[model samples]
Target: MDAAVAAIEESGPSGWSLRELARRAGVSHAAPAHHFGDKTGLLTALAAEGFGLLADALTAAGDGLLDLGVAYVRFAVRHRAYFEVMFRPELYRPDDPELTAARTRADELLGDAVRPLSPEPEAALAAWSIAHGFAGLWLSGALPPEVGTDPEAAARPVLGTLFPYDEDGRPAAEPPRER
Candidate 1:
């Protein structure tokens, strides 16, 4: 897993090959195929692992949406390879059972996190969008330098723009309207 992560991070989704991965891992060329079946299977496994790790991180975020958003960005920055593959279904087999279960776990974590904010199903979607958007930007260094490169420190203020907290640190206004 670590070897795959390193290769993906260094070479991107399309840049790395299974044979190269085996070479990097100091294993036989057929080792990765034997373990994961093929490149797609390897990527699928990576995505599943990434989602599972994301779920764990988000679950560990014990605060409100801001905290969860921060965790999301942090996870993306921390697990660049997994985070990258998790969203690129074409890079892996979307119908894989383990992949589906892992993705579901991550989705359920976000859904549960947003449940208390609103009964509207869209709330979960909005929460995910904002967090993911910010995280992606942060990962790409698209965020301005003023926001700082630190994921957690930068996330509080930026995410707060979408879900501002009052002086008492409670969610401001009317539960943050999406439309």
Candidate 2:
């Protein structure tokens, strides 16, 4: 898996062949095919692994939505190959059972993070979109220097927009105090 990820990162969107992955893994040329069936099957497992890792990070962030968003961006930059493969469904088995389970695990975590505010699907989708979009932009180097290189630092203010604070920097849902 590590070798495949390295190959993907080094090869770009066209990705690497199973034989190449086998060679990198120091295995027989048919080893990857025997285990994964084909390139898409291997990519499906890769995508599942990526989503599972993302779920672990977000789960560790706990109930803090801001921290969760920050972790999302950080994970993207740290695991560029996995992130790239995970989103390109056409490159893998989009309906693979393991992939679906992994995606659901991540989705459940995101749902828990946003449940305190509202259980609306729109809220979850909006949060996912912003975090995903921000990470994608950062990975692509499309974000200007003003955004800075620190994923968490750059994402803080952007995520704060979706999860704002009051005068005291507390969530606005809290009761107001005297001036």
Candidate 3:
């Protein structure tokens, strides 16, 4: 899996092939195909792994939805290949069970993160849409170039708009304050 991720990172998703993944893994050329069935299968598994990581990160951030947003953006920037594969259904088989499960889990995690606000689905969607849009924009360089220079600093204001915050810079309406 690490080999697959490294290959995708080094050469983009288009360059990732089962043979190349097997070669990187020091396995037979057919090894990846045997295990994954094909490139799409491998990508589905990869997306699942990425979403699992995302779910964990979101859970860890607890009521700090702003931090969760930051973590998400950071994850995307750091795992460009996996993030793209996870979100861009056209690039892979969306019907794959692994991909479907991953997507569901990811959404559940996001829902949990936004639940504290008692937001209606529309509000939750809006908050998620903004965060997702910002992350996508940051990854695509659609945001100011300087934003990348210090992503956390640049994103704080935008996150503040999307995240409920008290006057003291802490997440509002959360107690025990830890999720």
Which candidate comes out best when scored by lDDT? 2
The TM-score that candidate 3 achieves is: 0.83
lDDT of 1 by residue, 64-84 (tens): 777788888899988998988
lDDT by residue for model 2 (1-179), tens: 88888987898746678888888889999999999998888889999999999999898876777778888998999999999999999989888899999999999898888777766787789889999999999988899999886888899799878866554434568422323
The Cα local distance difference test for each model comes to 0.83, 0.85, 0.74
Counted clashes in each candidate structure: 0, 0, 0
Instruction: After superposing candidate 3 on the true structure, give the runs of residues whose Cα lies further than 4 Å from its correct spot.
Output: 167-179
The runs of at least 3 residues in candidate 2 whose Cα sits more than 4 Å from the true structure, single-residue gaps closed, are: 166-171, 174-179
Q: In what order do the candidates fall by lDDT, top score first?
A: 2, 1, 3
| Per-residue lDDT of 168 in model 3 | 51
Q: What is the TM-score of each candidate against the true structure?
A: 0.91, 0.91, 0.83
